[model samples]
Target: MTVATRLQSMQPTDIGVPGPTPGDMARAFRSVRRDPLTFLEQVTAHYGDRVSFPVPGAPALLVNDPDEVRHVLQVSARNWNKKTVQYGALARVTGQGLLASAEPSWIEHRRTAAPAFHHQRLEAVSDEVRAAADTALAAGLAGLVPGTGRVVDVAALTHRVGLDAVGRALFSADLTGHAQQLLDATSDAAELVVRLGRSVMPTARWAPSPTNVRLRLTRRRLDAITAQLVAERRSHGRAGSGAAYGDDLLGLLLDSGLTDVEVRDELVTMVIAGHETVAAALTWTLMLLAEHPDAQERARAELAGLPAPVSMLDHRDRLPWTRAVIDEALRLYPPAWAISRRSIGPDSLGGTDVPEGTLAIISPWVVHRRADLWPDPLAFRPERFLDPGAGRSGYLPFGLGPRLCIGREFAIGEMAVVLDRLLTTHRVAVPDGWRRPRPQAQVAVHPEGGMPLLLTRLRAERRD
Candidate 1:
């Protein structure tokens, strides 16, 4: 039988499901505001793995099973579309960018943009990534007070580092001048999206209000900046060489015959997706390392053996422990916590019937931490990734299939370079009584209060 037909054949009772009551819906909404991860866990706890929640005028299914998530995101991708609520906010900032656009358009855009992230292309930019990381680390360490030894906010430092890397690599420009402004804009846009997401009902695009106005303004500001950069590149020809800018991401996008609006959307998507996730992953990695000095020392030892002027691309495969640390961090705190999709046709996932127009919610936050899948789900253990026999399905920091992040390699390379440089030069330690910050699930899972740490330059002997 066809997937849709099979879905129709199953009765609601047979699916072991019931409509979310009014009280349940109210509580669910409240939990979404206060703590979305907890809210999802509560739903799963109360209603089992394949539960349907009342989404006002729409049908929504929260799928926690790894197999089901894989099927929705990969196998039967054609049967799904990005929920308007999620993409509506993204569309405001991105304007039909690959991330926000659905189906054929998104596919075309991805195809056009894929070459820029090809292995050969990214290898050429590895030096830029390492240089940006070095610049960020040097600045961070220089800011350290002399005697008192003030604590550094590692999360903040890493965000700056990640932004610097993306700026230098993607546009071949320094973002230091506009970093704070861009960050503010991105953060504000994320908040506005979350607020707008909760309030927006599906298929109510025509209904207009203040939120719409703010979204438009935010989009305009972001686009205006991106447009200026593109215009500058067009006028300048190429950086120094003036030879038409070979294979950088910007050049590739320009050569793809995309309109200015389309280019801006992709740029915005890359900046946000590429930088934010790397920064968060780096922050969490350092935080975890700080709590485990042995792991920190081992990672440092790995870095010590690296040749001078190390490029993450060259050393990523060589440094097994370093890669494992990043994996563990992602497992604990995936920046892209929840991925949502709207079903275009009826389907049965994990044996539950989902009708057309249903919202399928796949949360890495829940799946990675499920006690059944991960032993001591809350513990910080990088070694789990090193186990050759370990199941990989439950771990998806960059996602899977055709829609997987194109910048995955770039992110890994950048992180490895930064960590190698930082750990080799300084000892990062958390201040006593410094509580780990709760993750604010906005656009990415970033520490709300910033990750604070004490950085002490390693003595020559200590380095050995």
Candidate 2:
């Protein structure tokens, strides 16, 4: 028999976990392909927290129980590695960078990259964010009457600001000149990654199919940008630090004695992950605010009477309500919706026997929406976060455990700065008869068809 035929016959029936039959899955294949989120939610809800799947060869389990998720991501993290199909696709683009790297080496990589994101260093990120935000506002939304709202694509605006901020803060380089080129390449790369994830039969990266060819070109363009960045940094000669490179992430990577190819991989990884994730967060936050004007106004009020031109760190604790709104947005629409891992060894999770090589998928999208974990899970209530104890468990927006996102603070601060600044000068509201955008789960949960919102410039007196 063929490989597919042999594997299909070897489906696990005694895993001590419940899941849809292969026939049921076959019937829902189209729906699953079109909208994985809905399918996942429905399956989890139907099968309870820990559900197995009818995949051949390797067993697949969706771990939705909070404790099971914690066990996989935190308690038994070492037993799980990023060797699954989800991260495998990411590794194709990012190579073995921190985001997609497995353990042992990833430990060293994290140590090497830590200093660059030190508390003091990241404080400077607010300045970069403010500068980028100001530039984006001037270029994208310059002419606007207070009441006569203009239809604006805030998603694109967030992408610009996100790329600019990451470039400045981490690389100590301005990326405004290469923003469109880089964004287009990264966007294409993300689309390709999603397509790979959706495919029933995996395509080899070496195969010269149309998708593979496009991905090759996209990677080439990204490599070209990476080369430009490295060359410019070399020419500038450390920018007054007298070190071979400067005291930024690039410098740290260089000092770590990594090879040129290794450095390129990390740079590309940062360029994609650092910007795209935060941009999605920022864009989704804007969409949430636009849909709920009361919540938006409350958040804007918290921004008022703050120290003039406060830095990101300064605004961290001061804007509790605003921060609450952001927290809620992240819960509702986490950028990295699914975090997947492969079982490196035999382990029991949620009282289910998960064999070695099993795929354990933890979806923050589903976890965040669990009514048992979160009361009134569907409603957009920022007030829920006002309690200090809230979101201590079952919340993994930036993920949980040692593999938690290194740039969590950076992204959070950047979002706060952009949201604060935008709220100070303009009121964002959904246009009349505006339909909420269904999230398109790609590299991140992007709003379908883009987020077009109405922007009304606030009068100076209203700011007081």
Candidate 3:
């Protein structure tokens, strides 16, 4: 018998993971969509970890239990494919890149992209990264009315910096000019994707809805950017040799024998994934640091002893506190708040049988906040991560399983370098009377709007 035939035959009976009916689940879906981060907290609190929302298309199994998470994400990962709603919707923009691809293709893409992010290659990329960070610093620190106590939109600056770094890493180009369009367009696409993903009512992209129109236009603009870069790289970046395209993400994708459309899609994925997620992560970290001045001072003190701007290439090993700050921030506000998978065949989760095609949601946001996982899970404690051996089954900032973010080390390293520089140079604090921004779930758990902060240049005396 064929593998597919055997797997289909192995399908289990209907699971007893109790949840409300489709009608009630739709109401729950709407409530969570309103404020997903908070709604998830509320649901997990009242209903316990095995919360299921039985919507029309597929019933979702919301799991905060560690064993279930490990099973779905690791042990039975082959049966749990990325054909779920979130990945399907994201494939509209990213087009089967690492995160969205399934089976052999995903494995292939991951293999091709692995070497570029390997420690040695990253070490080689460090010089370019340092230069990129300098460019980003210029963009971030520019127009800051330093002595006059100007209110800086900290999140905006982080996006700019992240954009520049990813741009350099991708194609050795400065992408700040395309930053706003990329950010806004990504948000628009994500919002529409969520609507299509969750609603019992199906919406087609070909339909001429206003939001659909915007999505199309945004995609075309994004395609134009990727096309231009791909053209430049293929034309002048080695010609017939197929050697190297400046050792960036685009270069690696090009060398992998992917077609033009395939290359374009991966580029879109890299730009969108590489830029904004790190931006959101760093912005939240800085905000949290500002809220706790003591942590900020500790991170700054850690950085004081290390080399100023160059933290990559083995230099980052010294900045544990700085790394911890980013880690803790990621724990509290994981960029990818929810990871969904569809069971291709029979599977078991947290001791319950899962039927074919069930939607299983592993929420990093909810899992990170589990009171049983960490002491005072709600508090900002970077020191918790400082310990090498901590309760880790519940701590999934990037994710778990083979599908864990391939760029985790790169993103964290970039954040480490950027945060070290920012803390060394400034005293960051939230603006007076500014309320905490509500966490919204789209592609990632990003702040609903711009995060405003007051940044003062730290003087020599302020170091102590």
Q: Which has the greatest lDDT?
A: 2
Write one digit per residue (lDDT tens) for candidate 2, span 1-464: 54335334556646878888776776787788789999999999899898888887668899998999999999998999988777778877888889988747888888888887887887866677788887887788877756556889998999999899889889987899999999999999899888877676777778989998998899899899998888776676655554557678998888778887888888988989998899899898998888899999887877866856646675468888888888999999999999998989999986667778988898999999988878999889888889988866888998888999988888888888888778888999888888988998999999888899988888543221
TM-score of 2: 0.95
Backbone clashes under 3 angstroms, per model: 0, 0, 0
What tens-digit string does per-residue lDDT give for candidate 1 at 1-464?
54234333333322356545545565455567768877777778777777776444356778888889889888888888885577766776666777777747888888877877777767777778777777777677675433335588988889889888888888788888878877777777877767766552432445577766776777777877788889987886656654544477787788777888788889998888778889989999999998899999998988788765456565457888888888888889998888888888889887667678878878888888888888998999889878855658787787777778778888888888888778876888889897889888877788888899888776422221
When summed lDDT is taken over every stretch of 10 residues in candidate 1, the lowest stretch is: 6-15
- TM-score for each of the candidates: 0.90, 0.95, 0.91
Each prediction's Cα lDDT score?
A: 0.77, 0.84, 0.75
Lowest summed lDDT window (length 10), candidate 3: 3-12
List model 3 lDDT by residue over 137-157, tens digit each.
Answer: 556666654453456778778
Candidate 1: where is the Cα deviation over 4 Å? 1-15, 18-20, 56-58, 143-148, 200-210, 237-245, 314-316, 459-464
Candidate 3's C-alpha runs over 4 A off are: 1-14, 26-29, 143-148, 237-242, 313-316, 459-464
Looking at model 2, report the run of 10 residues with the lowest lDDT sum.
1-10
Query: Residue 296 in model 2: shift from native, Å?
Result: 1.2
Q: Residue 219: error of model 2 in Å?
A: 0.6
Better of 1 and 2 by TM-score: 2
- Residue clash pairs of candidate 1: none
